[model samples]
Target: MPKTQPTIRDVAAAAGVAVSTVSKYINGTQRFSGSVEAKLKAAIDALGYRSNPLARSMITGKTRTIGLAILDIRNPHFTNIVKGANRVALQHDYTLLLVDTEESQERERPLIEALAQRVDGMIISSRMPDDAVQWLLELSKPVVLFGRSQQFPIASVGTDGHLAASMLARHLLNLGHRRIAYLGFAKSRWNDERRRGIADCLQKAGLQLDVHDAEAPSAIAGERACSAILLGSSQPDAVICYNDLIALGFMKEARELGFRLPQDLSVVGFDNVSYAEYASPALTTVDLQSEKMGELAMTKLIAALNGSHDDEYAMLEPRLVVRESTMRRPDTSQPAGVTEMTPKTAGGRRRTGGQGA
Candidate 1:
């Protein structure tokens, strides 16, 4: 009822070559004359022959697979990173094995350990503590850190969150926002970096930030934090969110509460995700070059697998993108003490004549 699968011996016989020659060709251990190559190809095609990857790996001592562990697969920022890493892996004729830790520290070690058994090396974007990550280095596999940098003797690639947040803070400060609030994520690995950047910038102007933390990084968490931020004793002129999803949620809830965007309050977010520009009034955010970080991390890991002993660290610069979500605050000394909301036409374009900062 079933036919036997062709083996290397069958291929060699069909091509009229030695079994060793067929092995060399399949393993890419040596080159052959064009005639021999063509004959081998024809034989393999006719027999529908396929080499066993396990057997080949046994002989070569390389699985030719790289494992990538991400904290959360739902985030578009991490998705872009995967795209960049997969691209480089394919170019090098290697397979990429992906695992999502679901932002859980408990899942990271077990997932990484299981992946390590099958792959040649790993690229980890983890939420685990630093000591826990340092423990992983003892696995004896080439490991690259993604999305964060450290003084550890491992290669790492990440975006400068502090610098990016500082830029956003400065942008809002220049807009005359005196009472600024920062909405942060409790589980974020770089939350302190972003918060510190915003705080440091505001301190220069003799102002302090009103800090609030969301239980999670999702839009739901952001939407839930809206009441505390907007209904508090001291209302801020502007709010800076941890990421675009949170910012979008905050804006939606703020509007539902009858506050006009940038008229009653201003909002800014980080990680200029794809939909950030397509939001109702668009979103002002930071570009962290997520894809580039992925590419660099994969490249560095592959380099280590090739016996290159150098440790490299790459920190990408962030760019600020301004959109309609933020605007200059009304001058407090004005006779009216507040600026009137500008009317928008039916097509949703604001009629001209608003004052600029």
Candidate 2:
């Protein structure tokens, strides 16, 4: 009572050709004369024969699929990365299998292990420790790391977080923000690098950062951090968030708590996510070139799969984009009991009261 699907054999029989000829035509392994090509096409159309990808993969040992594992899909920064990787995958006729690790370290290894079995290669944006990543190399499948670089032999693509954060810290310092705070993501290596950059720059100017950690790199976590940052014993003149989502959350909570943007407080973030430019007053942030990172990672993975081992690590430079959310520190008095710091030059010399251009 059921109709059976046609196979390559059916097309070969209908075209009066050998089964190998049909296979070659279907796989594009050989080009035939125009008349032979026409005949095969006509026979394929008549029989409604479709090649089975699973069967072909069993024979060729290549699934023609790429696995992309990201930390959290809800973040626009990761979403843009996916777009760039998917574009390259499409161009190469490879299917992209996406998986979200949901920021779970425990899930990364098992998820990647399972995914690696069915894909030709993988691109991973993981929070796993470097030692844990070493195990992935044993799988024999090409893997390209996204967003973080390591000393391991695996290919990687990432932006320079330290440089990016250093630039942002210098910007805030130039704006006369002596009391600066950093809203960081907990347990993140990238966050550590950024904090170090900010701290290094501040230390050079004879100032230090007021550090706070968010449970996660999300708007809600950022909002929750407001209590510690704004209502703490000392209030900072400016806050640099780990990413745009956190910055946006902090801004929202700050406004609800009677603080005005760049007036009562100045705020900046990293990642330059789509929401950054569309926030109430727009946000000043660093551009990590997330999309380009994705493209490069995918490209590198593909190259590795093809036996090319050069360019194992690609690091993109970050750019700082200034917008409406940050401004020169207003000449206002500090909160009661909080010390006011005179703006200092990089060499530790105090400067007269004037904002940086």
Candidate 3:
């Protein structure tokens, strides 16, 4: 007769525990006492027991894996989020497959469809449309949103973009900045969420939204948009950027225009990325808790897999990080490139006030 493979049942028998106890331990469903946990581990090792999670999932109509759909992998903010999600997923023995839509929602749909076939669930961190999310819901698979929340019953885990934007705008407004411009790539749906946040603040204060366009979500794009704003007839006293890259780009261009940082134009950036602090003037930004958002999404996804949570959403708070990049409207200011700046610090390391510098 062929030898039988050591299964979870054998491990449970050896450990003197119910099969359900072993299952809970393996799937991260419930915690066990220290001694019991140790004995269970020993029993599994002694019996050479191995869990075929994939096979078991197959039997149960699950894949035991989750898919992550994101936009612009090059952005540091997104990168941090991926790291956080990966970390949390590993703890629960879950695997993550990432998909970058190249900032294109059209590509997002097909990619999500392809991935949904292989993974048990998905987390979308892109500019996906409501209709697309509804479509995913109809597919009968667990889906979660990373940044934006859907109107339907799918899960959402992210920072409060609107509140963050309002905080940034309010900071500038409090600094006596009357002419403020918001620069971003508004073509994408995700950007719209951020825009609405800033718009809410501006409207509340009886101020109009001065919007500008960017080529992309990079430093180069930020430079172009900021340059345009500088050349425009109505020069803004401050500019609220979509992200750190755009804000850095604007600062670079502002310098070329013989403008001094914070003296002539105070700039505020979102997503408090690493480079925010190392720039010539340092950058003031909103900390979106990207990593925490990722961690939360992973936790939620894992919980869903273990039947812990139904379809619930999680939202994290965003805090503002004030740094050297912004200060009271400069009393004495000049156009960009009027004065040369000193070389950056050693190792070219930018100071991270604490989190995203």
Highest lDDT among the candidates is held by which one?
2
The TM-score, computed over Cα atoms with residue i paired to residue i, of candidate 2 is: 0.86
TM-score of each: 0.87, 0.86, 0.77
Worst lDDT 10-window in candidate 2: 348-357
Off by over 4 Å in 3: 1-60, 148-150, 203-206, 330-357
- Cα lDDT of model 1 by residue, 1-357, tens digit: 799999999999999999999999998889999999999999999999999999999877789999999988888888989999999999999999999999787778898999999999999987764545676678889999865546468778887788888877877777778889999986677888999998987887778999999877778888999988999999998999999889999999999888899888889898778888888778878778888888989999988988887566788888777778998887743222223333223234322211111
- Choose 2 or 3, whichever is better by lDDT: 2
For model 3, how big is the CA root-mean-square deviation?
A: 7.0
What's model 2's lDDT at 239? 96
- lDDT by candidate, in order shown: 0.83, 0.84, 0.77
When sorted by TM-score, best at the front, the candidate numbers are 1, 2, 3
Residues 35-111, candidate 2: write the lDDT tens digits.
Answer: 99999999999888888999878767888899999999999999999999999989988999999999898888999
Top candidate when judged by TM-score against the true structure: 1
